[model samples]
Target: MIDQEDLELKCLGLIYTMVQNHLSDKQKEVKAELESNKAMENIYVFKSSTSLVNDMQVGKQGPIATRYAKSNKDISDVVDELQALLSKNSSKEGVTVDG
Candidate 1:
């Protein structure tokens, strides 16, 4: 029989999965947009398109890349902390869930 703890654990797991998926999706979208904009800038520019694209790509991606990495790490750390807490509590109380 499922209990309150089990339900809570399941919900937490689902929420964690959803958050991870959302982050992954957002990172991909951001990267795609950066690439797309860089390409569009190149296409619209006539002179110095190569140099322009290079500059634009770097300027656009630098801070965004850093922010993405930081945000990803932050999310991972939070999820890991929550997972550890749940595991610790479950083990201490001898709680087990069956898939």
Candidate 2:
């Protein structure tokens, strides 16, 4: 059987390792949540608009534009614009190599 001091030391070591593991996992979770919030912020920025582009096509199949193009080009244009803005912001923040 292990001595009392040895048992105490083992217990302390186990507790310390458990705390470290728990903290590491918690940090990862928090980081994920922060990233999620950042993406959400970017989405909010994308959606914000003015009366100028208010009539813009929410999707491709609207009424007139899609009736003519009959393609997803319009939506693709908006998505491209958003992606560009995201890219620009990331670039300004020194984030190259867009993931």
Over 1-99, each residue of candidate 1 has an lDDT whose tens digit, in order, gives 235354543323212212232346777786458557843453321111111122223565563322454445545665566656567768888985332
Please report the TM-score between candidate 2 and the true structure: 0.29
Worst 10 residues of 2 by lDDT: 10-19
Candidate 2: residue pairs that collide: none
Candidate 1 residue pairs in backbone clash:
none
TM-score of each: 0.31, 0.29
**Local accuracy by lDDT, each model:** 0.43, 0.43
Candidate 2: tens digits of C-alpha lDDT, residues 48-76: 12122222346454534434442345445
